[model samples]
Target chain A: MNDVYIVSAGMTKFRKHNYDEDFRLMVKRAFDYALNDADITHKDMDGSVSAYFSDHIQGQLIAGAMTNDYIGLATKPSKRIEGGGATGGLAFQAGYEEIASGNMETCAVYGFESMSHLNTWKGNDVIALGSDSNFDYPLGGFYTAYYALMATRHMHEFGTTPEQMAMVSVKNHGNAMHNPFAQSPMKITVDDVLKSPMVATPLTMLDISLMSDGAACVILASEERAKSLCKNPVKIRAIGSSSDTMRLSDRPFGKVPLLPNESKDDYKNLKYPGVHSFRAGRIAAKMAYERANINDPLKEIDFAELYDSYTSAEIQAYEDLGFCKYGEGGKFIEKGYSEINNKLPVNPEGGLIASGHAIGATGIMQAVYAFWQLQHSVKKHLKNGKLQVENAKRGVIHSHAGTGAYETVSILER
Target chain B: MKNDVKGTEIYKTDPLIKRWDYSLSYTHSYAQDSEFFKALGRNVLLGSYCKQCNYKYGTYRKYCMYCGSETADIELPLKGKIHTFTTCYYSGEPFMNDVPYTLILVEFEGIDSLFMSRLINKNNTKISIGMGVMAKFKSLQKFDVNDVYFIPEL
Candidate 1:
């Protein structure tokens, strides 16, 4: 297979947009910025892929074709990819495949979501379409309720506290203070997070990611083309995507009940057979690390940009991604291991919490942050005297959607 | 340098707004779902039993997820234990009117899957995981899916 490299990446500041700015305008801004960053004109592109979660909100179908025409790339073989919030990551995978198959020399991938047009309640109803309509939606369960169920179970099983979950929000909000592009960079305390109005049980309003309007783009090129056109290209070391049962009830919940003070050895011996915990993330990360030749993610990977759509999801990711053992995610965050200046910094750009979740834009935005981090150009993007990791060489980006139903993990190397 | 090149132009105007009132209807015809709902209309709890995998799905499923075989509809015991639960503090419309409502995931006896239902007649009763519960059906005013509720078992 041909090697793929990201020649350039661009992202718009994540926040609600004015009525005049629609998805098309956001896409144009990101597209132009990416072109400028890559030092290439639109005429040099062979094809493009557009990622957006819903045409229901935009009032259009086959939006990828429309986006191509709107950007004056109508003649190219363009397509739309949607996997709920993982749409951007899937689009990147498509662009990589296109170039790797020798079908295209360079491909431009972009993702955007314009949800500010609808009211919060209406927007939530539209986003809830990602759930299992037959089982989950009929019960009037939205993303928060689904995630709350998981959180409740995780707490019951592992003695994870609401305080630990709130710590995640406080830490990410602090990290966002340095990210100029963040939606809201206010410093928050665990007390504030706990005191915030509860959306669902155990999930306060602060525990959730903001729903915002934004766009992000990246230009992918084959290795040969990248070597000629770019000076510091970030190679796409490996990309893996996996999915689980759409219905949360169908997901594995581990057979053996979690015991207090269960050691890693006891966990291995007493754990139920044939039960896979966090099957989606574990499988995806395993495949990605294998392909990227990564043995120990915590030791080998320098930095990470995880999809923290919720505070608890980040904790779950810490365990699911093998950064820590199962049931240790809560303690992992409480110890401040994921802080920007720690041994391993996750989500230095504030993640979806502070950066805002524009669904389609989130995954590509993560890739952009990873690219900037690996290229050592993140200092200019910092706002409040935040220091970037020193001598960073490798990073991983994870995106998940539909309560662990769809997951994508990609490894990037400088 | 800017003499020949056109500078970026900003356009300001009142945005045109279009409103679409649309509703989509579908006649869902999953054989197992139909059977399950039909039984529910009669206040009977129906489950799908996958003999191939020896797994009984409390919620109706047409196919066995583990073994990929067709499942047969079977009657399930009305009582179960609370596997997990959450009291929703807020939600979207239709459910927004019923905020602070308790939703439970009940693990029925001899079933591999858990079923979700609202706990009716909660009446300040503190609910917890592993609490015994039984399914109770609403009056047969309509054959809707929201016709069943679970109450703490006596």
Candidate 2:
């Protein structure tokens, strides 16, 4: 199989657009930027894929066909992929495979979500469709409630405080000040996070990611094609995806059964053992690491772009991805390890928190940010003396959706 | 070119309005889900057990996820413990009227899977993990998933 490489990456500013600006125009602009960045024309592309999460909000279906047509690539082989928030990751994976299998020398992959067209509640309803309709939707369980359940349980079992969760928002918001493409770039403090309106118990409004309108694109090529067309191509080292039970209730918490003759020690030790476990993420990370030949993620991985849909989710990712031991995520962030200049910088582009979540575009946007960081192209975008990792060789981008049910982990190396 | 028409001659009309009313219905059926709902009407919780792999699912499943063998149905006790819970301060339209309500995930003693329900008397009682609770079924003219809830165990 041929190796896959990302030759170019581009994204639109992640924020609300004018009422007249639609997804087609957004994607066209992003595609143009990517082609220009790669120093290649559309003639080099053999196929394309579009990631669109929900058509309900757009009031249209067959978004992939629309995008491909608008970009004048309708004759080429094209398709659409969706996995809620992991849509971009899945689309990227598909494009990579197309090149790796030698079926196409180069492919264009893009993700976009035009969510600002709908009202807040309507958009929320569309997003809540990610949950199980029979069980979760009937009971009014949306993303906030589902994540809040995990946060509350984590606090009860691991002594993780709401303040620590607030720190995640503070750090990401601070980092956004340097990111020109961020949606809401405000220097917020932990106190601001605490004082923010509560969306769910133990989860303030700042703890959640924003629903924004944006588009992102990346051009993937075979090793031979990349060598001939572009310099500083980032190799796609490994990619893995994993899924769990659809309903949150079906997720395993690893609760030990209270056997009639079992010792008290066993009961005490087993109580709430997996309350904070992100089973899908752990599975995906393990698979990706093995394929990428990375055993020590915290040491080997120079930077990371985690899906911080919620502050608690990011804390859980630290443990799930084996960056630290279980229940040590809160303390790990407290030590300033995940800061921009720290040993392992995470979300130096501000992550989904301040960067804004454009659903389908988020995962690909993470990859785009990672590409810039690894290539040291992020220097021009930074302001206020923000530090970038020197000699950055490798990075990981993780994305998940459906209440932690679906997870994708990709490893990229310079 | 000189304008010949005055401002009063121009017609001011209301914006065009289009009422688009659409409804979608889905019919989903699985062996385990059918059995589970049937048992719900009788106020009994049904779970699936795989004799081949010794794997048990608290929610009904037609086939074992591990062994792929058809599982047998078993009735689970109503008593369980709160595994986790959260109170919603904001929610979607369907749940807007019931804001500030507590939703709980209950774990039965012998089952591995969990059951999600709302606490009926959340205002009068404080909620916490590991607290004992029991399932309470509503006497409804029509049976639905919302008919079941949880209350603090006596």
Candidate 3:
């Protein structure tokens, strides 16, 4: 396989673009920055993959072909890929695979979403299409509604609180204040987060992610091609993807997936509180670290961008990513760990919780932030003033599609 | 838990026993101004089909999403099954009906046959997830496209 390196990445500041910003318009803006950043043009853009997991929400299925028309490369091959919230991340995976398999020397991956026009309450009803429609949808359940159940269950099982979840919002938004692109740029307090209206009981309005609209683009090129055009090339040390049951009910509750051990049967309680999220994220993390030849993530990776469509997701990632031990997540945030200037900084880009989320645009948005941070070409919102992953060298990007149903964790090295 | 439980039924009897339902919004599109709007005015359920993928889908689009082919316009079924369902007791026509009402995901039977619509139940029966449901037309005189609801199979 050829060495796939991310030469350039660009993202729109996540906000409620409504229908005011069309998917094509957003993708074009991000694409301009990406290509220029890569020292390439539309003609040299060997191939392209467009992803926007929301034709139902606010698109007319005009994403794939219309892009090349704008670039005047109307004849170049292009296609659309969808895999839930990880649509953006999945686009990157496609571009990377294309480059690695010698199918293309360089390719552009882009994702766009316009979520403001959507009825946010309907999110539960719609994402259910990818799920077991009969079993899951009929129960009056949804992604956030189900996630709320996870939060409540986690709180019941391990004493996790709405306040600890708030602390995460407090920290990430503070990080986003340094990031000019973050939609929810206001620095908030735990009190502010807790006081916010409850969208899903345990998940207050602040704990839930914003209905953001934005687009992101990343240029993936072979190692040889990137070194020639780019000042700093980020290597894809690891590219791993895995999935779990789309039916949330099918997953054993209260059970977490453990590392494959000598005694696989030694660990029997798979139905623990935070198992699915950890299993999805850890399996991705382990595959990434294995390729990077690093065992420890907290110390080895400089800056990390984990998918946090909700506050609970980040806490799950901390344990799943081995940033902390299982059942230590609440304490993880309680002690100021995982915040900027701590042992490890997560979501300096404000994450989905504050940055606003356009399902397909979210995961790629995470990767773009990690890319900018690693190159010291960091955006303003995530610079965190005190310690912003100082001259970060290696970074990890994770995008979880529809809870833990689909996961992609990639390691990027400068 | 007790206050949340113990459900009650609601009935409405008024001078106007039957009334027409309506839903409409205006968006400017030259392409839609011609044939599409004409269909919408006639209450024709419009959809699109892709020749390349040999798949049919609803909620019309300009391009074929699965195969990236230019699409041909088509129509969807008026009836379907309850793909999933929900009961809402907190809100909706409080004075006429309350306690609980079911909203179902109805899957139509046709070529790549699919669709989801709300179900209006007057029986107060148990609304299961995978229950068979069929469209209940309110007659063109009293009907509106958005107001079309499904009834239980039996």
| Model 3 misplacement above 4 A | A18-20, A253-278, A379-387, B1-154
Q: Order candidates by DockQ, high to low.
A: 2, 1, 3
lDDT of 3 at A178: 66
Which one wins by TM-score: 2 or 3? Answer: 2
Residues B1-154 of candidate 3 have per-residue lDDT tens digits of 2577755432224322222223345463435324432454455655667888776654445466456788788876755555444444322121114324444445456545334345677754666545677655444532223334567776
CAPRI-style class, candidate 3: incorrect
Evaluate all candidate structures by whole-model CA lDDT and list the values in order. Answer: 0.80, 0.81, 0.68
Which segments of candidate 2 are over 4 A away from where they belong? A253-275, A381-387, B1-32
Model 3 local distance difference test score: 0.68
Clashes of each: 0, 0, 16
Q: After superposition, how far is residue A79 of candidate 2 from its true place, in Å?
A: 1.3
What TM-score does chain B get in every candidate?
A: 0.80, 0.78, 0.54
Query: Candidate 1, A136: how far from true, in Å?
Result: 1.6
DockQ value of candidate 2: 0.44
In the range A106-198, model 3's lDDT, one tens digit per residue, is: 888888787754455554455655554433343343555556555655665567777898999998887777676778877789999988865
User: TM-score winner among the candidates?
Assistant: 1
Q: What global local distance difference test value does model 2 have?
A: 0.81
